[model samples]
Target: MTALTLENFLPYRLSIASNAVSDAVASAYRALFGLKIPEWRLVTILAEGGAMSQQALCGRTRMDKVTVSRAAIALSERGLISRASNPGDQRSHLLTLSKAGWELYEEVAPKALELERQVFAGFSDAERQLLREMLDRIETAVERLEAKG
Candidate 1:
Protein backbone atom coordinates (compact mmCIF):
# COMPACT_ATOMS: atom_id res chain seq x y z
CA MET A 1 0.00 0.00 0.00
CA THR A 2 1.09 3.58 -0.57
CA ALA A 3 2.31 5.62 2.41
CA LEU A 4 -0.18 7.95 4.05
CA THR A 5 0.10 11.60 3.03
CA LEU A 6 -0.30 14.76 5.19
CA GLU A 7 -3.91 15.26 4.10
CA ASN A 8 -4.89 11.78 5.27
CA PHE A 9 -2.58 11.73 8.30
CA LEU A 10 -3.52 15.03 9.97
CA PRO A 11 -7.20 14.28 10.47
CA TYR A 12 -6.47 10.87 11.94
CA ARG A 13 -3.82 12.33 14.22
CA LEU A 14 -6.17 15.06 15.42
CA SER A 15 -8.99 12.59 16.06
CA ILE A 16 -6.73 10.30 18.06
CA ALA A 17 -5.38 13.20 20.05
CA SER A 18 -8.87 14.52 20.81
CA ASN A 19 -10.10 11.10 21.92
CA ALA A 20 -7.11 10.54 24.14
CA VAL A 21 -7.49 13.95 25.75
CA SER A 22 -11.23 13.49 26.28
CA ASP A 23 -10.73 10.08 27.87
CA ALA A 24 -8.02 11.33 30.16
CA VAL A 25 -10.05 14.33 31.29
CA ALA A 26 -13.14 12.23 31.85
CA SER A 27 -11.23 9.69 33.87
CA ALA A 28 -9.64 12.34 36.02
CA TYR A 29 -12.95 14.05 36.75
CA ARG A 30 -14.67 10.74 37.41
CA ALA A 31 -12.05 9.74 39.94
CA LEU A 32 -12.27 13.11 41.61
CA PHE A 33 -16.05 13.35 42.03
CA GLY A 34 -17.75 10.20 40.78
CA LEU A 35 -19.11 12.34 37.97
CA LYS A 36 -19.58 11.11 34.45
CA ILE A 37 -18.47 13.56 31.76
CA PRO A 38 -21.97 14.69 30.90
CA GLU A 39 -22.90 15.20 34.54
CA TRP A 40 -19.80 17.20 35.15
CA ARG A 41 -20.50 19.33 32.09
CA LEU A 42 -24.04 20.01 33.26
CA VAL A 43 -22.89 21.03 36.69
CA THR A 44 -20.19 23.28 35.29
CA ILE A 45 -22.60 25.10 33.00
CA LEU A 46 -25.21 25.56 35.68
CA ALA A 47 -22.63 26.78 38.14
CA GLU A 48 -21.28 29.32 35.72
CA GLY A 49 -24.48 30.50 34.10
CA GLY A 50 -27.06 30.04 36.83
CA ALA A 51 -30.58 28.92 35.75
CA MET A 52 -31.37 27.74 32.22
CA SER A 53 -33.95 25.65 30.45
CA GLN A 54 -33.40 22.02 29.45
CA GLN A 55 -33.05 23.01 25.82
CA ALA A 56 -30.66 25.78 26.82
CA LEU A 57 -28.60 23.32 28.82
CA CYS A 58 -28.32 21.09 25.76
CA GLY A 59 -27.19 24.04 23.70
CA ARG A 60 -24.65 25.13 26.30
CA THR A 61 -23.24 21.68 26.81
CA ARG A 62 -23.41 20.61 23.17
CA MET A 63 -25.15 17.51 24.45
CA ASP A 64 -28.22 15.81 23.02
CA LYS A 65 -31.68 16.37 24.48
CA VAL A 66 -31.88 12.87 25.98
CA THR A 67 -28.52 13.16 27.68
CA VAL A 68 -29.33 16.62 29.02
CA SER A 69 -32.73 15.49 30.25
CA ARG A 70 -31.27 12.49 32.01
CA ALA A 71 -28.51 14.47 33.64
CA ALA A 72 -30.93 17.15 34.77
CA ILE A 73 -33.26 14.61 36.28
CA ALA A 74 -30.41 12.84 38.05
CA LEU A 75 -29.08 16.09 39.40
CA SER A 76 -32.49 17.14 40.63
CA GLU A 77 -33.05 13.83 42.31
CA ARG A 78 -29.68 14.03 44.00
CA GLY A 79 -30.54 17.52 45.29
CA LEU A 80 -27.63 18.89 43.35
CA ILE A 81 -29.94 20.87 41.12
CA SER A 82 -33.48 22.15 41.03
CA ARG A 83 -36.05 22.71 38.31
CA ALA A 84 -39.08 24.96 38.22
CA SER A 85 -41.63 26.22 35.80
CA ASN A 86 -40.35 28.91 33.48
CA PRO A 87 -42.77 31.76 34.09
CA GLY A 88 -42.18 33.00 30.60
CA ASP A 89 -42.49 29.61 28.95
CA GLN A 90 -44.64 26.99 30.61
CA ARG A 91 -43.60 24.39 28.06
CA SER A 92 -40.00 24.50 29.21
CA HIS A 93 -38.83 24.40 32.79
CA LEU A 94 -35.87 26.32 34.17
CA LEU A 95 -32.95 24.55 35.76
CA THR A 96 -30.50 25.84 38.33
CA LEU A 97 -27.72 24.55 40.51
CA SER A 98 -28.82 24.05 44.06
CA LYS A 99 -26.86 25.07 47.12
CA ALA A 100 -25.34 21.61 47.16
CA GLY A 101 -24.43 21.90 43.52
CA TRP A 102 -22.80 25.28 43.93
CA GLU A 103 -20.85 23.96 46.90
CA LEU A 104 -19.69 21.00 44.85
CA TYR A 105 -18.76 23.26 41.97
CA GLU A 106 -16.75 25.51 44.29
CA GLU A 107 -14.84 22.47 45.44
CA VAL A 108 -14.39 20.93 42.02
CA ALA A 109 -13.72 23.85 39.76
CA PRO A 110 -10.22 24.56 41.02
CA LYS A 111 -9.27 20.93 40.94
CA ALA A 112 -10.61 20.69 37.40
CA LEU A 113 -8.50 23.65 36.37
CA GLU A 114 -5.48 22.00 37.91
CA LEU A 115 -6.28 18.80 36.06
CA GLU A 116 -6.48 20.78 32.84
CA ARG A 117 -3.11 22.30 33.58
CA GLN A 118 -1.68 18.84 34.17
CA VAL A 119 -3.18 17.65 30.91
CA PHE A 120 -1.39 20.43 29.07
CA ALA A 121 1.62 20.37 31.36
CA GLY A 122 4.14 20.04 28.57
CA PHE A 123 2.75 22.82 26.40
CA SER A 124 4.04 26.36 26.76
CA ASP A 125 1.54 29.21 27.03
CA ALA A 126 2.29 30.31 23.51
CA GLU A 127 1.89 26.82 22.17
CA ARG A 128 -1.45 26.44 23.96
CA GLN A 129 -2.70 29.74 22.60
CA LEU A 130 -1.64 28.84 19.08
CA LEU A 131 -3.28 25.44 19.36
CA ARG A 132 -6.56 27.00 20.53
CA GLU A 133 -6.50 29.60 17.74
CA MET A 134 -5.85 26.98 15.09
CA LEU A 135 -8.61 24.75 16.43
CA ASP A 136 -11.06 27.67 16.48
CA ARG A 137 -10.22 28.55 12.90
CA ILE A 138 -10.63 24.99 11.74
CA GLU A 139 -13.95 24.64 13.59
CA THR A 140 -15.26 27.87 12.08
CA ALA A 141 -14.26 26.81 8.59
CA VAL A 142 -15.85 23.40 9.00
CA GLU A 143 -19.07 24.96 10.36
CA ARG A 144 -19.27 27.28 7.38
CA LEU A 145 -18.69 24.42 4.98
CA GLU A 146 -21.36 22.36 6.73
CA ALA A 147 -23.79 25.28 6.52
CA LYS A 148 -23.27 25.52 2.77
CA GLY A 149 -24.16 21.89 2.28
Candidate 2:
Protein backbone atom coordinates (compact mmCIF):
# COMPACT_ATOMS: atom_id res chain seq x y z
CA MET A 1 0.00 0.00 0.00
CA THR A 2 1.15 3.55 -0.74
CA ALA A 3 2.23 5.56 2.31
CA LEU A 4 -0.18 8.40 3.00
CA THR A 5 1.30 11.89 2.74
CA LEU A 6 -0.69 15.13 3.17
CA GLU A 7 1.53 17.05 0.76
CA ASN A 8 0.88 14.48 -1.97
CA PHE A 9 -2.91 14.30 -1.36
CA LEU A 10 -5.16 15.90 -3.97
CA PRO A 11 -7.95 16.63 -1.50
CA TYR A 12 -5.56 18.39 0.84
CA ARG A 13 -4.08 20.43 -1.98
CA LEU A 14 -7.54 21.31 -3.29
CA SER A 15 -8.71 22.38 0.17
CA ILE A 16 -5.62 24.50 0.82
CA ALA A 17 -5.93 26.30 -2.48
CA SER A 18 -9.66 26.80 -2.01
CA ASN A 19 -9.17 28.24 1.49
CA ALA A 20 -6.42 30.57 0.38
CA VAL A 21 -8.49 31.94 -2.48
CA SER A 22 -11.63 32.21 -0.41
CA ASP A 23 -9.80 34.00 2.37
CA ALA A 24 -8.33 36.55 0.01
CA VAL A 25 -11.66 37.18 -1.62
CA ALA A 26 -13.41 37.29 1.72
CA SER A 27 -10.99 39.90 2.97
CA ALA A 28 -11.60 42.04 -0.06
CA TYR A 29 -15.38 41.71 0.17
CA ARG A 30 -15.33 42.60 3.86
CA ALA A 31 -13.12 45.60 3.32
CA LEU A 32 -14.90 46.94 0.28
CA PHE A 33 -18.52 46.11 1.06
CA GLY A 34 -18.82 44.85 4.61
CA LEU A 35 -20.15 41.59 3.22
CA LYS A 36 -18.97 38.13 4.11
CA ILE A 37 -18.59 35.52 1.37
CA PRO A 38 -21.95 33.96 2.12
CA GLU A 39 -23.68 37.34 2.28
CA TRP A 40 -22.20 38.38 -1.02
CA ARG A 41 -23.25 35.07 -2.49
CA LEU A 42 -26.84 35.55 -1.38
CA VAL A 43 -26.89 39.13 -2.68
CA THR A 44 -25.50 38.11 -6.03
CA ILE A 45 -27.90 35.21 -6.32
CA LEU A 46 -30.93 37.28 -5.40
CA ALA A 47 -29.83 39.97 -7.83
CA GLU A 48 -29.56 37.52 -10.69
CA GLY A 49 -32.29 35.02 -9.87
CA GLY A 50 -35.01 37.28 -8.48
CA ALA A 51 -37.10 36.53 -5.40
CA MET A 52 -36.57 33.14 -3.82
CA SER A 53 -37.42 31.43 -0.57
CA GLN A 54 -34.61 30.53 1.83
CA GLN A 55 -34.99 26.87 0.89
CA ALA A 56 -34.57 27.75 -2.78
CA LEU A 57 -31.56 29.89 -1.94
CA CYS A 58 -30.03 26.92 -0.13
CA GLY A 59 -30.49 24.73 -3.20
CA ARG A 60 -29.16 27.37 -5.57
CA THR A 61 -26.18 28.28 -3.41
CA ARG A 62 -25.31 24.84 -2.07
CA MET A 63 -25.11 26.65 1.29
CA ASP A 64 -26.58 25.08 4.38
CA LYS A 65 -29.85 26.38 5.80
CA VAL A 66 -28.17 28.09 8.74
CA THR A 67 -25.73 30.03 6.58
CA VAL A 68 -28.43 31.08 4.14
CA SER A 69 -30.76 32.07 6.96
CA ARG A 70 -28.11 34.16 8.67
CA ALA A 71 -27.15 35.91 5.46
CA ALA A 72 -30.80 36.54 4.60
CA ILE A 73 -31.41 37.99 8.03
CA ALA A 74 -28.36 40.21 7.81
CA LEU A 75 -29.28 41.47 4.36
CA SER A 76 -32.85 42.07 5.40
CA GLU A 77 -31.78 43.96 8.49
CA ARG A 78 -29.53 46.14 6.39
CA GLY A 79 -32.40 46.96 4.02
CA LEU A 80 -30.42 45.43 1.19
CA ILE A 81 -33.02 42.75 0.75
CA SER A 82 -36.71 42.55 1.58
CA ARG A 83 -38.76 39.48 2.39
CA ALA A 84 -42.27 38.90 1.18
CA SER A 85 -44.66 36.01 1.60
CA ASN A 86 -44.08 33.56 -1.21
CA PRO A 87 -47.13 33.35 -3.40
CA GLY A 88 -46.41 29.75 -4.20
CA ASP A 89 -45.96 28.84 -0.56
CA GLN A 90 -47.27 31.26 2.01
CA ARG A 91 -45.39 29.43 4.74
CA SER A 92 -42.05 30.51 3.33
CA HIS A 93 -40.88 34.02 2.53
CA LEU A 94 -39.25 35.00 -0.73
CA LEU A 95 -36.26 37.32 -0.60
CA THR A 96 -35.63 40.00 -3.20
CA LEU A 97 -33.04 42.69 -3.44
CA SER A 98 -34.14 46.17 -2.55
CA LYS A 99 -33.09 49.18 -4.60
CA ALA A 100 -30.13 49.61 -2.30
CA GLY A 101 -29.13 46.01 -2.93
CA TRP A 102 -29.29 46.47 -6.71
CA GLU A 103 -27.16 49.57 -6.34
CA LEU A 104 -24.64 47.72 -4.22
CA TYR A 105 -24.49 44.80 -6.67
CA GLU A 106 -23.87 47.16 -9.59
CA GLU A 107 -20.90 48.61 -7.72
CA VAL A 108 -19.51 45.31 -6.48
CA ALA A 109 -19.81 43.16 -9.60
CA PRO A 110 -17.16 45.05 -11.56
CA LYS A 111 -14.72 44.98 -8.67
CA ALA A 112 -15.38 41.26 -8.28
CA LEU A 113 -14.67 40.69 -11.97
CA GLU A 114 -11.50 42.74 -11.78
CA LEU A 115 -10.36 40.70 -8.80
CA GLU A 116 -11.06 37.51 -10.76
CA ARG A 117 -9.02 38.80 -13.68
CA GLN A 118 -6.13 39.68 -11.42
CA VAL A 119 -6.21 36.20 -9.85
CA PHE A 120 -5.98 34.54 -13.27
CA ALA A 121 -3.87 37.18 -15.01
CA GLY A 122 -1.10 34.81 -16.04
CA PHE A 123 -3.54 32.22 -17.36
CA SER A 124 -4.84 32.41 -20.89
CA ASP A 125 -8.58 32.25 -21.59
CA ALA A 126 -8.33 28.64 -22.64
CA GLU A 127 -6.48 27.73 -19.46
CA ARG A 128 -9.14 29.42 -17.37
CA GLN A 129 -11.86 27.56 -19.24
CA LEU A 130 -10.06 24.28 -18.76
CA LEU A 131 -9.68 24.96 -15.05
CA ARG A 132 -13.37 25.63 -14.79
CA GLU A 133 -14.15 22.39 -16.61
CA MET A 134 -11.87 20.45 -14.32
CA LEU A 135 -13.48 21.99 -11.22
CA ASP A 136 -16.93 21.10 -12.52
CA ARG A 137 -15.82 17.52 -13.10
CA ILE A 138 -14.40 17.32 -9.62
CA GLU A 139 -17.67 18.56 -8.13
CA THR A 140 -19.59 16.01 -10.14
CA ALA A 141 -17.31 13.21 -8.99
CA VAL A 142 -17.70 14.26 -5.36
CA GLU A 143 -21.48 14.48 -5.75
CA ARG A 144 -21.55 10.94 -7.16
CA LEU A 145 -19.56 9.68 -4.19
CA GLU A 146 -21.85 11.51 -1.81
CA ALA A 147 -24.92 9.99 -3.42
CA LYS A 148 -23.47 6.52 -3.02
CA GLY A 149 -22.53 7.13 0.58
Candidate 3:
Protein backbone atom coordinates (compact mmCIF):
# COMPACT_ATOMS: atom_id res chain seq x y z
CA MET A 1 0.00 0.00 0.00
CA THR A 2 1.22 3.54 -0.77
CA ALA A 3 1.39 5.66 2.34
CA LEU A 4 -0.21 9.07 2.07
CA THR A 5 1.71 11.93 3.64
CA LEU A 6 0.09 15.35 3.69
CA GLU A 7 3.49 17.03 3.79
CA ASN A 8 4.26 15.51 0.41
CA PHE A 9 0.78 16.03 -1.02
CA LEU A 10 0.59 18.61 -3.81
CA PRO A 11 -2.73 20.11 -2.76
CA TYR A 12 -1.69 20.40 0.86
CA ARG A 13 1.63 21.97 -0.09
CA LEU A 14 -0.05 24.40 -2.47
CA SER A 15 -2.56 25.46 0.17
CA ILE A 16 0.21 26.06 2.68
CA ALA A 17 2.26 28.14 0.24
CA SER A 18 -0.78 30.13 -0.85
CA ASN A 19 -1.76 30.89 2.73
CA ALA A 20 1.76 31.98 3.57
CA VAL A 21 1.85 34.47 0.70
CA SER A 22 -1.70 35.65 1.45
CA ASP A 23 -0.80 36.30 5.08
CA ALA A 24 2.23 38.32 4.09
CA VAL A 25 0.26 40.42 1.62
CA ALA A 26 -2.60 40.79 4.11
CA SER A 27 -0.25 42.10 6.75
CA ALA A 28 1.15 44.73 4.39
CA TYR A 29 -2.29 45.81 3.18
CA ARG A 30 -3.60 46.05 6.73
CA ALA A 31 -0.66 48.07 7.88
CA LEU A 32 -0.70 50.44 4.91
CA PHE A 33 -4.41 50.83 4.19
CA GLY A 34 -6.39 49.13 6.92
CA LEU A 35 -7.69 46.75 4.29
CA LYS A 36 -8.27 43.05 4.76
CA ILE A 37 -7.65 40.55 1.99
CA PRO A 38 -11.28 40.42 0.88
CA GLU A 39 -11.58 44.20 0.93
CA TRP A 40 -8.37 44.57 -1.03
CA ARG A 41 -9.60 42.01 -3.51
CA LEU A 42 -12.83 43.92 -3.99
CA VAL A 43 -10.99 47.19 -4.40
CA THR A 44 -8.67 45.79 -7.03
CA ILE A 45 -11.52 44.19 -8.93
CA LEU A 46 -13.60 47.34 -8.88
CA ALA A 47 -10.60 49.42 -9.90
CA GLU A 48 -10.02 47.33 -12.96
CA GLY A 49 -13.65 46.68 -13.95
CA GLY A 50 -15.53 49.78 -12.79
CA ALA A 51 -19.01 49.42 -11.28
CA MET A 52 -20.36 45.96 -10.50
CA SER A 53 -22.82 44.27 -8.21
CA GLN A 54 -21.65 42.30 -5.19
CA GLN A 55 -22.82 39.16 -6.97
CA ALA A 56 -20.63 40.05 -9.92
CA LEU A 57 -17.72 40.75 -7.63
CA CYS A 58 -18.20 37.41 -5.91
CA GLY A 59 -18.03 35.59 -9.22
CA ARG A 60 -15.02 37.55 -10.47
CA THR A 61 -13.05 37.30 -7.26
CA ARG A 62 -14.04 33.69 -6.46
CA MET A 63 -15.14 34.99 -3.05
CA ASP A 64 -18.38 33.96 -1.39
CA LYS A 65 -21.25 36.45 -1.25
CA VAL A 66 -20.89 36.92 2.49
CA THR A 67 -17.23 37.82 2.22
CA VAL A 68 -17.93 40.20 -0.65
CA SER A 69 -20.82 41.80 1.25
CA ARG A 70 -18.72 42.35 4.33
CA ALA A 71 -15.95 43.93 2.32
CA ALA A 72 -18.40 46.11 0.43
CA ILE A 73 -19.97 47.31 3.62
CA ALA A 74 -16.62 48.13 5.17
CA LEU A 75 -15.49 50.02 2.08
CA SER A 76 -18.76 51.95 1.99
CA GLU A 77 -18.38 52.88 5.64
CA ARG A 78 -14.92 54.22 4.90
CA GLY A 79 -16.28 56.34 2.03
CA LEU A 80 -13.99 54.46 -0.31
CA ILE A 81 -16.86 52.95 -2.28
CA SER A 82 -20.40 53.92 -3.18
CA ARG A 83 -23.42 51.86 -4.13
CA ALA A 84 -25.87 53.14 -6.68
CA SER A 85 -29.14 51.50 -7.60
CA ASN A 86 -28.70 49.36 -10.67
CA PRO A 87 -30.71 50.68 -13.60
CA GLY A 88 -31.57 47.19 -14.77
CA ASP A 89 -32.11 45.60 -11.38
CA GLN A 90 -33.96 47.27 -8.53
CA ARG A 91 -32.85 44.58 -6.10
CA SER A 92 -29.14 44.96 -6.63
CA HIS A 93 -26.90 47.99 -6.37
CA LEU A 94 -23.75 48.58 -8.38
CA LEU A 95 -20.65 49.32 -6.40
CA THR A 96 -17.97 51.71 -7.59
CA LEU A 97 -14.87 53.28 -6.17
CA SER A 98 -15.19 56.86 -5.03
CA LYS A 99 -12.54 59.46 -5.88
CA ALA A 100 -10.83 58.75 -2.59
CA GLY A 101 -10.89 55.09 -3.41
CA TRP A 102 -9.18 55.75 -6.72
CA GLU A 103 -6.47 57.69 -4.96
CA LEU A 104 -6.04 54.84 -2.49
CA TYR A 105 -5.81 52.40 -5.36
CA GLU A 106 -3.06 54.44 -6.96
CA GLU A 107 -1.12 54.27 -3.74
CA VAL A 108 -1.79 50.59 -3.21
CA ALA A 109 -0.97 49.41 -6.70
CA PRO A 110 2.73 50.22 -6.62
CA LYS A 111 3.05 48.81 -3.10
CA ALA A 112 1.37 45.63 -4.24
CA LEU A 113 3.76 45.29 -7.18
CA GLU A 114 6.64 45.88 -4.81
CA LEU A 115 5.37 43.20 -2.45
CA GLU A 116 5.02 40.74 -5.31
CA ARG A 117 8.55 41.51 -6.40
CA GLN A 118 9.89 40.93 -2.90
CA VAL A 119 8.10 37.63 -2.67
CA PHE A 120 9.09 36.37 -6.12
CA ALA A 121 12.51 37.99 -6.42
CA GLY A 122 14.27 34.79 -7.29
CA PHE A 123 12.03 33.86 -10.23
CA SER A 124 13.05 34.84 -13.75
CA ASP A 125 10.39 36.25 -16.09
CA ALA A 126 10.09 32.94 -17.89
CA GLU A 127 9.80 31.05 -14.64
CA ARG A 128 7.11 33.43 -13.45
CA GLN A 129 5.19 32.98 -16.70
CA LEU A 130 5.50 29.22 -16.43
CA LEU A 131 4.28 29.30 -12.83
CA ARG A 132 1.27 31.36 -13.85
CA GLU A 133 0.51 28.91 -16.64
CA MET A 134 0.77 25.97 -14.27
CA LEU A 135 -1.54 27.62 -11.77
CA ASP A 136 -4.04 28.40 -14.51
CA ARG A 137 -3.92 24.81 -15.68
CA ILE A 138 -4.50 23.61 -12.15
CA GLU A 139 -7.49 25.91 -11.83
CA THR A 140 -8.90 24.65 -15.11
CA ALA A 141 -8.46 21.03 -14.06
CA VAL A 142 -10.13 21.68 -10.71
CA GLU A 143 -13.06 23.42 -12.39
CA ARG A 144 -13.49 20.51 -14.75
CA LEU A 145 -13.41 18.05 -11.86
CA GLU A 146 -15.95 20.14 -10.00
CA ALA A 147 -18.23 20.19 -13.01
CA LYS A 148 -17.97 16.44 -13.35
CA GLY A 149 -18.98 16.01 -9.75
Candidate 4:
Protein backbone atom coordinates (compact mmCIF):
# COMPACT_ATOMS: atom_id res chain seq x y z
CA MET A 1 0.00 0.00 0.00
CA THR A 2 1.16 3.54 -0.67
CA ALA A 3 1.87 5.90 2.23
CA LEU A 4 -0.99 8.12 3.31
CA THR A 5 -0.67 11.83 2.68
CA LEU A 6 -2.19 14.85 4.44
CA GLU A 7 -4.19 15.80 1.32
CA ASN A 8 -6.06 12.50 1.34
CA PHE A 9 -6.11 11.77 5.06
CA LEU A 10 -7.33 15.17 6.14
CA PRO A 11 -10.39 15.15 3.87
CA TYR A 12 -11.34 11.60 4.88
CA ARG A 13 -11.07 12.43 8.57
CA LEU A 14 -13.01 15.65 8.14
CA SER A 15 -15.78 13.86 6.22
CA ILE A 16 -16.09 11.21 8.90
CA ALA A 17 -16.17 13.78 11.68
CA SER A 18 -18.71 15.88 9.77
CA ASN A 19 -21.02 12.92 9.18
CA ALA A 20 -20.83 11.79 12.76
CA VAL A 21 -21.59 15.24 14.10
CA SER A 22 -24.38 15.73 11.59
CA ASP A 23 -25.98 12.42 12.45
CA ALA A 24 -25.82 13.04 16.16
CA VAL A 25 -27.26 16.51 15.90
CA ALA A 26 -29.97 15.40 13.48
CA SER A 27 -30.98 12.61 15.80
CA ALA A 28 -31.06 14.91 18.82
CA TYR A 29 -33.16 17.53 17.05
CA ARG A 30 -35.57 14.95 15.68
CA ALA A 31 -36.04 13.26 19.02
CA LEU A 32 -36.35 16.45 21.03
CA PHE A 33 -38.46 18.65 18.72
CA GLY A 34 -39.39 16.64 15.65
CA LEU A 35 -37.36 18.99 13.54
CA LYS A 36 -35.12 17.91 10.68
CA ILE A 37 -31.82 19.57 9.80
CA PRO A 38 -33.34 21.90 7.21
CA GLU A 39 -36.21 22.86 9.45
CA TRP A 40 -33.90 23.53 12.34
CA ARG A 41 -31.68 25.63 10.12
CA LEU A 42 -34.62 27.74 8.96
CA VAL A 43 -35.80 28.25 12.52
CA THR A 44 -32.35 29.21 13.72
CA ILE A 45 -31.92 31.74 10.94
CA LEU A 46 -35.32 33.29 11.55
CA ALA A 47 -34.64 33.48 15.25
CA GLU A 48 -31.39 35.30 14.73
CA GLY A 49 -32.36 37.55 11.83
CA GLY A 50 -36.00 38.22 12.83
CA ALA A 51 -37.21 38.24 9.22
CA MET A 52 -35.72 37.63 5.80
CA SER A 53 -36.62 36.66 2.28
CA GLN A 54 -36.39 33.05 1.16
CA GLN A 55 -33.47 33.93 -1.11
CA ALA A 56 -31.71 35.59 1.78
CA LEU A 57 -32.45 32.58 3.98
CA CYS A 58 -30.98 30.28 1.36
CA GLY A 59 -27.78 32.30 1.53
CA ARG A 60 -27.75 32.44 5.32
CA THR A 61 -28.49 28.75 5.84
CA ARG A 62 -26.55 27.54 2.82
CA MET A 63 -29.56 25.45 1.86
CA ASP A 64 -31.07 25.03 -1.56
CA LYS A 65 -34.12 27.02 -2.65
CA VAL A 66 -36.46 24.03 -2.73
CA THR A 67 -35.46 22.90 0.75
CA VAL A 68 -35.87 26.39 2.14
CA SER A 69 -39.22 26.85 0.46
CA ARG A 70 -40.51 23.52 1.71
CA ALA A 71 -39.28 24.19 5.22
CA ALA A 72 -40.85 27.64 5.18
CA ILE A 73 -44.19 26.21 4.11
CA ALA A 74 -44.03 23.45 6.72
CA LEU A 75 -43.11 25.87 9.50
CA SER A 76 -45.90 28.21 8.45
CA GLU A 77 -48.40 25.36 8.47
CA ARG A 78 -47.23 24.39 11.94
CA GLY A 79 -47.93 27.95 13.07
CA LEU A 80 -44.26 28.40 13.88
CA ILE A 81 -43.65 30.97 11.15
CA SER A 82 -45.44 33.36 8.87
CA ARG A 83 -44.63 34.42 5.34
CA ALA A 84 -45.57 37.81 4.01
CA SER A 85 -44.93 39.74 0.86
CA ASN A 86 -41.60 41.48 0.65
CA PRO A 87 -42.28 45.18 0.18
CA GLY A 88 -39.24 45.70 -1.98
CA ASP A 89 -39.66 42.59 -4.10
CA GLN A 90 -42.95 41.40 -5.50
CA ARG A 91 -41.61 38.00 -6.38
CA SER A 92 -40.23 36.95 -3.00
CA HIS A 93 -41.80 36.71 0.40
CA LEU A 94 -40.24 37.49 3.76
CA LEU A 95 -40.27 34.85 6.47
CA THR A 96 -40.65 35.69 10.13
CA LEU A 97 -41.00 33.73 13.32
CA SER A 98 -44.38 33.73 14.90
CA LYS A 99 -44.95 33.65 18.67
CA ALA A 100 -44.96 29.88 18.54
CA GLY A 101 -41.75 29.90 16.57
CA TRP A 102 -40.02 32.04 19.13
CA GLU A 103 -41.24 29.72 21.87
CA LEU A 104 -39.95 26.70 20.03
CA TYR A 105 -36.59 28.38 19.46
CA GLU A 106 -36.35 29.18 23.15
CA GLU A 107 -37.12 25.58 24.01
CA VAL A 108 -34.73 23.99 21.52
CA ALA A 109 -31.77 26.37 21.44
CA PRO A 110 -30.43 25.25 24.81
CA LYS A 111 -30.76 21.59 23.89
CA ALA A 112 -28.96 22.22 20.62
CA LEU A 113 -26.16 24.04 22.42
CA GLU A 114 -25.83 21.17 24.88
CA LEU A 115 -25.70 18.66 22.05
CA GLU A 116 -22.96 20.64 20.29
CA ARG A 117 -21.00 20.99 23.52
CA GLN A 118 -21.20 17.26 24.15
CA VAL A 119 -20.09 16.55 20.58
CA PHE A 120 -16.99 18.70 21.00
CA ALA A 121 -16.42 17.87 24.65
CA GLY A 122 -13.18 16.01 23.94
CA PHE A 123 -11.52 19.10 22.47
CA SER A 124 -9.81 21.56 24.78
CA ASP A 125 -10.48 25.29 24.49
CA ALA A 126 -7.22 25.91 22.69
CA GLU A 127 -7.81 23.00 20.35
CA ARG A 128 -11.30 24.17 19.56
CA GLN A 129 -10.05 27.67 18.86
CA LEU A 130 -7.32 26.37 16.61
CA LEU A 131 -9.74 24.12 14.77
CA ARG A 132 -12.10 27.01 14.19
CA GLU A 133 -9.33 29.26 12.93
CA MET A 134 -8.02 26.59 10.59
CA LEU A 135 -11.48 25.84 9.24
CA ASP A 136 -12.11 29.54 8.64
CA ARG A 137 -8.84 29.84 6.76
CA ILE A 138 -9.68 26.85 4.61
CA GLU A 139 -13.13 28.26 3.86
CA THR A 140 -11.63 31.61 2.89
CA ALA A 141 -9.12 30.03 0.58
CA VAL A 142 -11.80 27.95 -1.13
CA GLU A 143 -14.03 31.02 -1.53
CA ARG A 144 -11.17 33.00 -3.01
CA LEU A 145 -10.46 30.27 -5.51
CA GLU A 146 -14.12 30.04 -6.48
CA ALA A 147 -14.33 33.79 -6.89
CA LYS A 148 -11.42 33.77 -9.32
CA GLY A 149 -13.15 31.35 -11.60
Judged by TM-score, which candidate is best? 3
Query: Could you give candidate 3's per-residue lDDT for residues 1-149 as a string of tens digits?
Result: 99999999999999999999999999999998999999999999999999999999998999999999999999999999999999989999999999999999999999999999999999999999999999999999999999999
Per-model tally of clashing residue pairs: 0, 0, 0, 0
TM-score quality measure for candidate 3: 0.96
Runs of candidate 2 with Cα error greater than 4 angstroms are: none
Q: Over the stretch 1-149, how does candidate 4's per-residue lDDT look in tens digits?
A: 98988657977888888889889989988998888888999999999988899999998877899999899988888999988899999998889999999999999999998987987899999999999999999878877998999
Q: What is the lDDT, from 0 to 100, of the residue 95 in candidate 2?
A: 94
lDDT of 2 by residue, 33-116 (tens): 999999999999998999999999998899999999999999988999999989899899999999999999999999999989
- Predicted structure 2: lDDT: 0.94
Highest lDDT against the true fold, candidate:
3
Candidate 2 similarity to native, TM-score: 0.95
Query: Which regions of candidate 4 deviate over 4 angstroms?
Result: 1-7
List residue ranges in candidate 1 displaced over 4 A: 1-9
RMSD of each: 2.6, 1.1, 0.9, 2.4
* Superior by lDDT: candidate 2 or candidate 3: 3
Per-residue lDDT of model 1, residues 105-149, tens digit only: 998899888978998899999999999999999888977998999
